[model samples]
Target: MKMFMLKSLCLAAIMLIAVLTGMQLASSGIQKMKGYEDPNLETAVSFHEKDNNVKASILGNDISSHNIAAKKKKLEEISAFNFFSSMGKKLSNGITSASEKLIQFIAD
Candidate 1:
């Protein structure tokens, strides 16, 4: 019973890792194909121009305006890696180092 439980737990962990990896790969591929850009970095402008006169109100007001503007915003490129995978790596490395240290301490 104990061995069966251990095997089941290990299988679940492996399946979870596989699913996360597949999702990360699919997300990265779609982003690359679509040329995805960060919308949060985008910029916009809103302006209001008005000319008011008392005489114009009684008579008629004629206003002509010409404006030309251009703006460019820099955007950050999306990383192809996911947080879970990166964190998993860091966690595994930490665990490995900790175990090695424990072994060295025990030996000495």
Candidate 2:
């Protein structure tokens, strides 16, 4: 029990050190890349700024919530077939059938 505890403690300490080292290396690498990146090449507005602008533009337009819901309903109606759900059903059926066959074989 003592040996197991010592090994587990050592493993935890090693993992902690590894994680801290990885974080330090990643941060230093990011800083190094930032120094090489050109200021002129950078975007005037950050990604969050651009995202906010898009959201504001969308809200500013004379689009109603009812219209958006109607559009969504139309799209859903157009693609009535759900490929993933059908695939999942087929996969589960196949697995169940295979397991039953394996159990029958083992019993016999």
Candidate 3:
């Protein structure tokens, strides 16, 4: 049972690492795609000026601000989770190393 649990834990760690790596890769890819500056700023502004609705614009800005706040909170949560996960990984590695050393000493 202990061995099974260890195997399961290791599998979970591997899966987590893979998922994090994939997310990093995907984010980097998106960043790369965003390297170019938007070339239609004047055109966009002209279009917006043509159909300017004050109330709707204010509502849209409010919604955008809310979305930004939500995304910021989610980013913070993800950062905290990442920190804890990394600490756990380091602790597990230290324990594993200490156990292996103790086993070697006992054998000798």
Which candidate's lDDT is highest?
Answer: 2
Off by over 4 Å in 3: 36-108
lDDT of each candidate versus the true structure:
0.58, 0.68, 0.64
Q: For model 2, how does the per-residue alpha-carbon lDDT over 1-108 read when each residue is reduced to its tens digit?
A: 999999999999999868756765665576677887544442222223354443212212433457789999999889878899999999999999999999999999
Q: Which ten residues in a row have the lowest lDDT in candidate 3?
A: 41-50
- Model 3 residue pairs with clashes: none
Cα distance off (Å), candidate 3, residue 37: 9.1
What value does the lDDT take at residue 28 in candidate 1? 57
**lDDT string, candidate 3, 1-108, tens digits:** 999999999999999868756765665566567795444311111113335542213212333456779999999888755788899999999999999999999999
The order by descending lDDT is 2, 3, 1
Residue range with the least summed lDDT across 10 consecutive positions in model 1? 66-75
What's the CA error at residue 33 for candidate 1, in Å? 0.9
lDDT of 2: 0.68
TM-score, one value per model: 0.34, 0.33, 0.33
TM-score attained by model 2: 0.33
Badly placed stretches (over 4 Å) of model 1 are 38-108
